[model samples]
Target chain A: MPERRSQRSIGGLTRRQVLGAALGAAALGAVGFRPRTAGAAQPPIRIGFCVPLTGPYGSEAQDQVRCAQLAVREFNASGGLNGRKAELLVRDSKLSPDEAATRTLELIENEHVDFVAGSLSASVQLAVNNITKQHRILYNSISQSDAINEPKDFSRYTFHEALNPTMTTDAVGRYAFPRFGKRVVFLLPDYAYGHEMTRGFKRVGKEFGIEVLSEIRHPLGTTDFSVFFPRIRALKPDVLVCCNFGRDQQITLKQATDFGLKRAMKIVYPILLYTARLAVGPRAYQGVVGGTSYYWGLEKTVPAAKQFNDRYRAAYGGRVPSDYGAFGYAGVRTILASVRQAGSVETDAVIRRMEALHYDFYKGPEYYRACDHQAVQSVLIVESKPAPADNQFDVFKILEVYGPNRVHLRSCRELGYS
Target chain B: MAALTPELLALQLLVGLALGAIYVLLAFGLSLIFGMLTVVNFAHGAFYMLGAYVAFAVAGLTGNFWLCLACAPVVLGLIGYGVERFLVSPLYGRGIDYPLLLTFGLSYVLVEAVRIIFGKQGYPFDSPAALAGSVEILGNYFPLYRLFVVAATGTIVLALWLFVEWTNFGLIIRAGARDPEILRVLGIDVGRVWRLVFALGTAIAAMAGVLAAPLQGVTPEMGDSMLIESFVVTVVGGMGSLGGAVLAGLLVGLVVSLTSVVAPELAKLSIYALMAAVLLIRPQGLFGRAGLLG
Candidate 1:
C-alpha cells in the first residue's frame, strides 16, 4: 500500500547513509585497483651467478655471463616475473672450490639473492651446491657433472641446466660407436667429472656393443699431450674418445691433429665446446662427431632459438652464442618461469612448481624432471663441418636429436632421489 | 698386458724424444738462472707463457708463424732485462728466499695479468701449412711439426753448449756462478753479468714458449705444468749444470713417455722416481760438478 506513495522516492533514507555506501564502494575499488607501474611495492628479484670470471674457465664464464645478461634483459623488457624487474649479480668463483663456496655464501647471506646460476667447472659447481643446499637457495648448474645428480650430491634446490656426463655420453656414444667402431680408447681428465664421464661412456657404450680398449686418465691441466698421443696411436683403436675439457681439450685435440689421430681412426669428443673447436680450427674439427646442447646455427630450424640468436647477435656485436651461453640463458629463464607459475618467489614454492615442469626456451621441448632435477631435453648430435664463407658460427650440422627419455638415466630412484 | 711391437716402440721413442726436447729447453733455462742468480726464478714459467701469448698475438696480426717465433724471444728477453734490473737488483744481498719469494709473487702477477689480457680460452696458432702433416719413418707415422721441434731443440741445445763452452761471456757467466764475489774483485761487474745471464735464461724459456705455441694452444696457465717439470729436471740433473739438465730432461721424458704407454697412472710418478734415484746415487747429478752439490 505504501508502495503507491512513491516507488522512486528515497523514503527515510539519510544523507549520511548514502555517503557511507559511496565511501564503502570507493574503498572496494581502491582494494582491487592495480597501478601497473612495474610492481612498485615489490623488490627486484636477484639471481647470483657464481662463475669463474678470472680463472682457468674465465673466458667460458664470460660467454655464459653474456648469455645470462641477454636472458635477464629480455625477461625485464617483457614485464618481468609477476611484473617485478629481474636483477643478476655476478661473482667470480675464481675456479677454486673454496672460493666458489665463499662467493655462493656471500650471495645467499649478504646479497640475499633469490636463486643462483653459472659455474663452468664441475668442482666449482659442487662447492657452490653445498652452500646453496644448506641455504635452500635454488642452484641451476651449468657444469656437466654426473656427480651433481648423484643421490649423495642431490638436493631439491639444485637443478642441472646443462647435460650430465651420462647424457652427453649417451647422446654421443650411441651415434659414434656404431658408425666409427666398437673399440674405443679414452683420454680422460684426472678429476671427478672426468672419471664420471668415463663411467658414463662405459655404462652407455656397453649397451651399444662397444669395447673400451684402453683409457688414460691424464692429470687435469696437462700442458703437453704428446706422450699420450703416441700411446693412442700405438693402441690403434677404432675410435679415440677425448674426455678432457678447457685448455686440456684444446691442447689434446690440436696435438691429436698434429699426431694425425684423425687419419688413423674416428676422433670423437663426448662433450665438445665451441671455443675449443674454434681453438682447434674448423679444418681439424671437420668430420669430428660430438654432442652439444645447443648451437647458434640451429636458429634456422627453431624459431624460438632464432629469436634468441637474433637478439643475442644484435646485442653482442655479432658474436654467435655457444652451447655454454645457451645453458646460462635457459637456466635463468627456467628459474624465472617457475617463479611466474608459482606466483611466488619462495624457494620451496618455486622449486615445487619447477619439478615436472615442461617448458621450451629456444631449444625444443624441455622439462626439469621431478626426480633428479636434471633438465630433460633433446640432445643434439652434431657433426662439425666447414662453415659457409658468410657465416662463422655455422660450424655444426645437427645430425639427429635424441629425446630425454632415450638419453636420460632412469637411475634417479636408485640414486636415492624421490 | 700387450707386448710392445717394434712399430709401437719406435713411435714411443720418437714421442719421448720430442717431449725430452721441450723439457730440455725449460730445464736449461732454469739451470742457467739458478747458477748465476742463486735465486730460482719460479716466474720463469710465466715468462714462457708470455712468449706464447706474444707469439700468438704476432701470428694473428702478421699471419706469419716464423715472425711470431722470431719476435717472442726478443720481446721476452727485453722484459726479462727490465725485470732483472729493476726487481732483482736490490735483492742481491738478501737471502735466496727473498728473490725466490719475489719471483713467486711475480709468477702470480704475470699469470693474473695474462688472464686479464688474453682470457682463459686458448688461442691456437696452427702449425704452418708446411708442417701440418705427418712424416712416415720406419713404419711409424710421426708428426712433422714434432720432428721439427726435436730437431730445433737439438740444434739450440748444441748451440747453447758451444756458446757456454767457448764464448767469453759464457766463461764470465760460468765464473760468476762459481764465485760472484771473486768475479767482482777481479774488476768484472758481477751485477751486470747476473742481469745478462738472467735475461738469457728468460729468453731461452721464451723460445720454448714460441715453439710450444703451435704444439699446445696458447693459454695463460699453459706454463704451470712446464714449471713443475723444469724444477724436477733441475733437481734430477745437477742443481746448476746445463748439460746435467739436458740429460735429466731426456731421461725424465723417456721414462714418462714409455710408462705412459703401458701404465699412464705411473707416468707422472716415474719422473719423481728418477729424481729420487738420482738423489740417492749421485747427489751431483749426471754431468754436475761435485763442488756445485754444496
Candidate 2:
C-alpha cells in the first residue's frame, strides 16, 4: 500500500516525475555547476623549462630539471600563489640555438606556459630570449652570458638569474691577479661563450695591469690539446686562463695537467662548474682557482643556503645542488614569488614585482637591475680541493666570498642602454 | 705569440707520433675487419667506447690499470663474437649494405645502452701512477703516458705483424680475405675464420679505447669523433690495407698537428683535404688494391 502510494502522485507530481527532476538536477550539477574555491577554480601555473637535455651538458640539464621540480613543489606546498598550484613543462633545447627557439615557440603557442626558464648554453639562451620577447612571455635565463644582458638583446620580459661573464671574471681576476701574477695567457674555445669570457677577462686584466701573453683559439670539441700544449708552455705566462666549458673544460684541464703546464703557471677558469670538478676528479682539478655562483659550503654561514641545501639533499638522494642546479631553483622560485607578490599571473604585474623584489632565496641578497634585468648576485672564489674529502661533493674550498658590491658588473650605459 | 722554437718543433713531432699511434690502432682494426669480412664496421667506435667503459669499470673494481687494459679486450672480443654470430651472420651474402646498416643500428643501441647504464657524464680515468706526470724532453715537458702509448703501439704492431706473416691461422685469414670460395674448397670453416677475424678486429679497437681512456675520460659518446677520424684514416690508408693504415695515420697526424700551429681552425679540415687530394690522385687509396669495392 505504501509502494502504491509512492508510485502515485506526490502533490501534483508522480514519484517517477520527482525522481527524474532530482536526477536531472544532479546531472546538471556534475556537468556544469561548481563552487568557486581558490584551489579548484584556477588552473595550475605552467612554466616551460627549455634546456640542453641531449648534449654535452645533459647531466647538468638533468640536475637543473630536478632542482626546478623542487622549486615547483615548494611553491605548491606554500599555498601556491593564492591556491593555484604550479607545474613545469620541460623541453630539450639540445644545446642548439635553432632548436631552442623552436622549443620555446612551442611552449608559448601550444603549451601556453605562463613563464619560460632554462638554457645552459649562452647562444641557446639568447635564442630562447628572442622567442619569449616576441611572445611577451617572462623568461628567466639561468646561464652565464654577457650577450643576454646587452641592450641589443635585453627586453622587459627577460630576467637573467645567472651571473654574467663580466661579474664572474671580475671576481676571479680581483682574487687571482695580484696572487697568481701579471702575465696571463688564454686558451679559448672558438665560440660565443668562450669569446665573451675572454673579453671579460681582458677587461678585468686591463684594470689590474696584467699582460696578456697570447690568445689561442682552438676548435670546439678538440679532444687533442697536445698540439696547443707546446705553444702554451712556450708562452710561460703567470696564469693560464682557460675560457672553455663542459667537456672542453675537462679535457683542457686534464691535458694541461698532463702536459705539466700547471707546474709553471696558475690555471684560472672564469667559472669552474661543480659537475666538471666532479667529472675530472681532484688531481686534474685541484689547485685550480676559479669563481662560482654558488658553493654548498655556504650552508655553514648562510641559513637560507642551509635550508635550500637540506631540502635539495632530502629530495635528491642526499646530494647537494650544483652551482648551475642552484640557478634552476632560483630561476623558477623568483618567477613564482613575483607572481605571488603581484597577486596575479599577468605579465606586466609580475614584471613590476620582479623589478622591485630584492631576494635572498639561496646564496645571498640579489636584485634585478632595472635597466638590463640582470641579477646582481654574489660570486664565490673557490679552489679545487687538493685531495678527495670524506664527502665527494666537498671538492672546492672557498677562498673568498665576493659580495655583489665587490663584484664589478657592467653598467647599463656601458651595455648601450640609454 | 710564442716563437716556434726548435725544441717546441721537436716536441710537436713527438706529439704527432703519439696521436698517430691511436689513429693507427683504430684504423688497423677497421681495415682488418673490412679485409676479412668485406663489411664496414660502422660500430667500430661503439666497440672502442665500450672498451673504455669496461676498462673504467674494471679499474674501479680492481684499482689496476694494466688489468683493466687486459680485461677490456677480452670482454669486447666476446661481445664481438656474439654480435657476429647472432646479429651479423644472417646478413652475409646480402651485400655490404645490410651489415653496414645493421652495425650502424647496433652502434646507436650500444651507445644508448651505455648512456642508460653509465649516465651521460664523463668519468676520469687516471694514468697509471708510474706514468702520472710529465718528463722533461726536448727542452719542454711531455706527458710520460704519451711516450708509453707510442712504445705500446709499436710493440703491438710488431706482434700483429709477426702473427699475420708467420702463423697458419694468418694464412687461413689471408685466404679468406682474398677468396672465401677457395678456403671453402680447401675444407676450411670460412665462417669460423670470419668470426675470429671480427673478434680480433674488435679486440684491437678495445685496446685502443683502453689506451685513450686516460687521455680523454670515458663517456658514452667518446667514440663518436674517434669513429670519424678512424674512418678517414682507413680510407686514406687504403681500404683493407694494414700497412696503409699505419702510414696514413702518421701522415694525417703530422698534417693536423702542423696545421694547428698555423691555423687551428683548419687543423681538423686538413685531414679531409688530404683524403680528397689523395682520392683525386689515386681513387684506390695509398695501399688499397684497385677495384676491390667497385
Candidate 3:
C-alpha cells in the first residue's frame, strides 16, 4: 500500500508535458466564444421569405435570409418602417414547387407576413407567384422568371426585382456583339430558364448581326457531357455560350475545358456568378467573361454602390459580395424605397409604388424600370482573371457595363406577356 | 453522316465511362443486395450520402483524401452489417414487404439525420488538387477529374467482379444466396455470409459516395433523386447480374443525354418508361435470374 502510493506521486514531471496539457485546455477555451443575447422588441413587422432552404440552392436561400434579416436590422436601427419594428418570417420550401406553394400560404395566413419575397429556386418562385396572385398580396419576386413581368403571368400584385433571362442576355448580346463577332453556338440547359434565355440570346444575337450557328440543350444534371461536345466541335462557332446555372455551370465549364472547346472557339458564358465561383476556385474559372448585377470594386460608376458594398462587407465580416447576396441586399433596398413611397404597409399601395414609380436603384443602370416593374439595373460584363492564391469568387476583369435603356425589352404584348 | 472526332469521341467515351462507373458502383450494391436477400435496398442512396459526408469530415480532419476514400467503405460496411444483424435479420424469413417498409423508413431517418447535421446547405467538396485540370481529346476539352472518376469506378468494379467470382468467400456468398439454409446444413454460418454480403454491397455504395463527393454537389436530400435512378438501373439490368447493370447504366446515360436534345422535362421519366417496357417484355429483367432480381 505504501509502495503504490509512492508510485502514484509526481516524481518525473517535465516542463514540456505540463505546457502541452495547459496549451490543449487553452486552445479549447479560445475556440468557445460567449454568445450575445438578442434584445427584445415590440410588435415587429413580419416579412415572409420563401426560399429553397434545404435543396440545391440552399446557399442562395441562406443569402436571401441574411439580406432580409440585415435589412430588417437596419430598418429597426434607423427607426424602422413608419417607426414600427420589422421582423423577417423565414420558411424553407426545400426547393420544391408544391412545398413553396404551401409555405407561401402558411406565411400569408399563419405567419401573417405583411409582404412576401421570392425564393432561390425558380420553380419555387413560380409557385409563390401563383399563390401570391391568388391572395392579391405583394410579391417582390427575385425569380429569374420573365413571366412575372409578362402581362399574361404578371399580376397587379407581383413585382420583379431581378433581371429576366431575356433582360440578362439582352445586355450580354449588346455588349459582346462587336467584340465577340457573333457566330454563336447555344449550349443552353434543357429547361424553361434555358428556353427563355435561348430565345433572348437568339433575339439579341440576331439584332446584333450575330449568326445563330447551332443550338444544343443539355439536361440539367447530365453527368456526361460528351455527346454535346461533338456537336459544338463540329460547329466551331466564334462564341460558344453555355447558359446553365448552379452546379451545371461549373460542370459545363470544367468539361468544356477537357473537350478543348476553348482552343477551337472562344467560349462565352452568359452569366458566371457567385455559386459557381465557390464550387470552382477563381483560378479554375479564369478566361471566362460573364454578366453580374454588381461587384464590390464597381463603386465609382454607381456612386451609391460603395455604401452598399461597405455595409454589406461589414455585416458579413468582409465576405465578398456575391450576386445572390447583392440581389438580396438591393432587393431589400428596393422594397424599403417602395415601402417609403407607399407610406403604409397596405399591400396594394406597395405594389402600386413598385409598379408606377421609377427610382435610381444604385445597383446598376436606370435603377428600376417602370415598364415591367423589373430593375433596369446595370449588368457588369467581366472576364475571369486567374489568381495567385485560391479563393472563392476570385475571378474576372470588368469588360463592359450595359444599362437598362440600352438593353430594352420588347413590350409585354410582344412577349405574349398578356 | 455525323461529325465525331477522335478527341470528341474520347471526351464522350470518358463521360460515358464516368457515368458507367457510378452505375457500376450503384448497380453492384443493388445487385448484391437483391441477389443475397431479394430486397431492393431502396435506402442504398442514403448510405451513399452517409459515406460522402463521412469522407468529407475525415478528409477535412486529416487532409488525407485517399485515407478518407479507403476508410469510408469500412465504416459504411460495418453500418450495413449492423443493419442486417439487427433490423434486417428478423425479416429474413418473413415477407419481402417487411424489409422494404423498414428500409424505406430507414431512408427517411437517414435523410433527416443528414439534414440535422449538415443544415441543408449544399456542402461543396473540392476535388483533389492532383487531378483538377482538363484533358483534351479530338479538340474537345473534358475534365481530368471525370477521367479519374472513370478510372476509379472501373478499378472498383473490376476488383469487385474478381472478388465475387474468384475468391473462396465469394463462392460461399453466392452459394449462400442460392440456398442459405443448405449452407447451414454444410456447417457454414449462413447468417455471417448474409451479413458479409449485405456489408459488401453497402460498402460499394459508400465508395461510390466518396468518388461522387467531389464531382457532385452534396446535400442532405441528394439521395432522394438518386434512389429512384439506381432502382431504374437495377430494374433495367435485370436485377442480379453485374454485367447487366453496367450495360443498362450506359444505355440509360445515353438516353438521358440524347433526349435532352428533344424533350428536356421527360428526360428523367424516360428511365421509368424504359423500365416499364422492359417489365412488359422481360419481367425477369435482361439478366436477373427468373424474377429473382426483386
Taking chain A by itself, what TM-score does each prediction score? 0.87, 0.89, 0.83
Q: State the iRMSD of every prediction, in order shown.
A: 14.1, 12.4, 8.7
Best by TM-score: 2
| Candidate 3 deviant stretches above 4 angstroms | A1-42, A121-123, A221-224, A355-368, A388-394, A412-418, B1-14, B133-136, B139-143, B254-270
| Segments of candidate 1 deviating more than 4 angstroms | A1-43, A54-56, A81-83, B289-294
lDDT of 3 at A186: 81
**lDDT tens per residue, model 2, B1-294:** 778888877787888899899999999999999988988999999999999999999999999999988999999999999999898999999998999999999999999888666765567788999889789896677899999999998888888888888899998888888899989999999999899889989999999999999888787888998999999999999999999999988888888887777777788999999999999998979999887775
Clashing pairs in 1: none
Interface RMSD of 3: 8.7
Q: Give the distance in Å from residue A259's predicted Cα in candidate 3 to where it truly belongs.
A: 3.1
What ranking of all candidate models by TM-score puts the best one first? 2, 1, 3
Q: Over the stretch A1-418, how does candidate 3's per-residue lDDT look in tens digits?
A: 2212211221112212222322332243245321112453444555667677565566666666556655656776787666766655556687678988987897787656678876765556778989888888777777676666776666777777777778788887777777777788887777677788888888888778888877777666554455566667766688888887766676667656655677777777667666566656654366777777666657766766766666656665565566775676556656666787788788777767776666654465444455566766667787877644754344567788776656666675675644
Q: How many pairs in model 2 have backbone atoms within 3 A of each other, for residues 3 or more apart or on separate chains, i.e. clashes?
A: 0
Per-residue alpha-carbon lDDT of model 1 for A1-418, expressed as tens digits?
1111111111222222222322332243235421223326786788888777654455566678767877877777788876787766666676789988987887787667899988878787899999999898999998898888887787889899888888888878888888889988888888887888888888878888887788888887776787877667666799988887766777777777767778888988877778667646687676778888887777778887888888777776676778887898999888888888888789989998889578878777888777788888878888888778897667788888787667766576667765
Could you tell me every candidate's TM-score relative to the true structure? 0.90, 0.91, 0.87
* Per-residue lDDT of candidate 3, residues B157-242 (tens digit): 78988998999998998897788888889999888888888899899888988888776646666666777788888888888788
Model 1 residue B249 lDDT score? 89
